[model samples]
Target: MELKAISDDEKQRYKTVVLKFLEDLSYNLDDKAIINYINKLKKEFAPKTARMHIIRIRAFLKFIDHPIANLIELPKVPKRRRRLVIKVEHVRDLLREIDEKLSGPYRLKLKSAVLLSATSGLRAEELYKLRLEDIDLENRTIFVRAEIAKDYEDRVTFFSKEAQDVLEEYLNTFKPSNPLFSKKSLLHQFSKLDTRLRMKHMRKFFSQQSDRLGMPTAVKKILMGHSTAGDVDLSHYDFQDEEELKKIYDEYWKNFRILG
Candidate 1:
């Protein structure tokens, strides 16, 4: 049952075949004969969308105890990557595409949400889950607890000057302590407005600004609260020097640049 213990042949004959079987089952049994088809639906879509379907099918196979039920090959699909850092100019185009004709609270909410996620690297879920207390205006940082971050690691996110300005406006003027975007779902509501703002797009927007600002990759990763790539364990040291994290976080904010 451990992955390392499974022989290559067993993986091929059992795991690979099991995956194909589940795909065939989901596809063939679909009521419309194309109802649950991923390939049919994903011509221009990211492969990860299709991969999610595969994951659902895998979960179903496990639940049902089908052939090769205990084994599954990891499906090869494109990952939904975060955006590379760029400047505000690139995001300006996207903002134009949005309901630019609209202004005031709705506009502020949209811009603030997008900018915070882009600059601070908050996940869409984290944005939704963020509390008023999470943002420290005096410190110009956003703290994500272990429960909210993608990884279990805790990190404080720094904000750009413009981001701080907009957030301050949002915090001081409207929806002071409420959810930044109070809808059940941002994309869902935007769907009605004919503007679907996805997490991927938000990251892409962030990356463009970050890239333009000439942010270092390491800083980007750190701001995003991702675990570093190398074998070095900064977490261990941070654990011992918990107070140091706040210092580092504040230092990072001290150098942050905002866009016009």
Candidate 2:
């Protein structure tokens, strides 16, 4: 599993689930035992979350050359009917609320996080793992490292000038050598704010706004670190150089701008 490049968090989850399985079933390792375990998980967690647990458990069984791994099937997850759309005004209001209710370094750090997520479509975990070395302030670009990326693919993503300015201010003030944001700290502060928006919503905001502004689908996928496996443009056509991608992002910056 380690050689497979599974993320640390994923590895930990697998470990926890496997340990529980061993404690409950005591190496019974039969189809019935697995079914019982999955039933327990369904009662304890949401359908999607329980499905994830089963998937991880199946991977562990396969790793150990267990015959039942292939026979195990995943439970169906209900599809979400409503998708939340975040508008520019929503983001503006959230930022304004943060500015009014918070102060000092915490305020700047949270603001920087919001802008970066809104403009770059970076995942929350990716933002938390961001380091000073990953950022190029002059170019307004971020280098998402392979280990930190969800898909474990290294990619370059651009941020708006607004994000650059705020990030520069935060860096200049704190001069942090560690990761740019702490998952716990940022989430805690965000929860305190009186808004319907969550950190996850920022990435959706970026995706929607970019599409509205006419960003090519291929470019959007690349910037967001999404798999373009069968995409004709990304697969056959020559990929845009960093300068070209930056130019495209710059053209959409007006819509991305959250504050004056």
Candidate 3:
């Protein structure tokens, strides 16, 4: 079977998860064994992590054409409490506080990243995976390659002019050819700050900004790279003209902007 469809990282994760699960049993591959394994995982791991393990197992079983693959069922992952989104008025103030505390290249990197995340709604993983070529400063757009995307599908997203300006300055200074932000760099920079003020909160900022600005739900979902799989109508809506999406982005981009 073609297990090479997933990335090396994901494959390694599959290995680790499967091994841990197998160790819990006597290497059984029956539905009862699998369900029992999931029960064990529910106690040991977070609901989301446990759900992911079940998904991986299901995929693997299907790929190998195991008999029980069709019979396995996964439990719903419990909903997590929403994180507090950064308010619109506090946007510039938070950026200013972080910028003032740090200096030189570190300051530029974190500030630029936060601006991009706030404006574009790209996840930290997606932002870190960005390469210099992925950005189009003149057009105010960023192309997220499928491999780096969480959905395993390629899509385009946009940034505000304010974010574009900061990004341009950053590109001019760093002149990056590979990934724009290293995992270590993002982790180190975010670790120093309060949890409420961390890089992850920028996504919440983008969500709230979209609501406050009244961006169309369709446009907002596209910009955020959210999958419209179950929404029968939205899947078709997603296929409409890219230029129209860009127009909406351009029209509403400034509504999320931070003060200089």
Which model scores highest in lDDT? Answer: 2
- TM-scores for all candidates: the values are 0.62, 0.79, 0.70
Given candidate 1, what's the lDDT at residue 163? 69
Question: Which one wins by TM-score: 1 or 2?
Answer: 2
lDDT of each: 0.60, 0.86, 0.79
Write candidate 1's Cα lDDT for 8-40 as tens digits.
655555555446644666645433433334344
For 1-260, candidate 2 gives per-residue lDDT tens digits of 77876668878988998888878999888888877887889899988998988898888899889888898888889998997888889999999999998899889999999999899999988999998899999888899999899999898988888888898999999886578788888988888899988778889998998888888777887889888787889654227787877787788763357886
Model 2 alpha-carbon miss at residue 36, Å: 5.2
| Model 2: pairs clashing at backbone N, Cα or C within 3 Å | none
- Once fitted onto the true fold, the runs of candidate 3 whose alpha carbons sit more than 4 angstroms away are 1-83, 230-233
State the TM-score for model 1.
Answer: 0.62
TM-score winner among the candidates?
2
Ranking by lDDT: 2, 3, 1
